[model samples]
Target: MVSLSDYLILSSIIFCIGLAGIFINRTNIITLLMCVELILVAVNTNFIAFSHFLGNEAGQIFVFFILTVAAAEVAIGLAILTLLFRVRGSIDVDVTNSLKG
Candidate 1:
């Protein structure tokens, strides 16, 4: 039988992997976005696990809202990335500095 600690540990591991990915790969915007999504997923996993173990729906509800926000964020991020690529011809994060006025 899996315990709450087990779930927490799993969530932490996932979160760490996502964090590491973000730090190690700073060249591509797509990889950064994916790492961010992975972090969100890790958070969602923790919410679901705690909600189930505690017999409360609040965590689950929070996860739902988090997912909704994540979806919107991804949409907006992709749109901006598309425009950046169209203008700069590259999706490199370092190139984004030129956008600063």
Candidate 2:
């Protein structure tokens, strides 16, 4: 039987992987966005696991909202990425830093 601690450990592992991906691969905006999504997935997993174990619907509801927000974020992020690619011809993070002016 799986316990809450097991779920927590799984979530933490996923979170760490996502965090590491972001830090280790700073060259591509797409990779960064993917890592952020992975982190969100980890959070959602925790919410679902806790909600199931505690017999409460609140965590599930929060996951629903988090998913909704995540979707919107993806849409906007992709749009920005598209524009950046169109203008700069490259999606490298360092290339974006030159747009400050």
Candidate 1 Cα deviation (angstroms), residue 67 = 0.8
Q: What local lDDT score does residue 85 receive in model 2, on the 0 to 100 scale?
A: 91
lDDT (10s digit) by residue, model 1, range 1-101: 99999989998998999999999996999999999998999999999999999999999999999999999999999999999899899999888786556
TM-scores for all predictions: 0.91, 0.93
Once fitted onto the true fold, the runs of candidate 1 whose alpha carbons sit more than 4 angstroms away are: 99-101
Model 1 global lDDT (CA atoms, 0 to 1) = 0.93
lDDT (10s digit) by residue, model 2, range 1-101:
99999999999999999999999996899999999998999999999999999999999999999999999999999999999899999999889675465
lDDT of each: 0.93, 0.95
Tell me the deviation in Å of residue 70 in model 2: 0.5
* Per-candidate count of clashing residue pairs (backbone under 3 Å): 0, 0
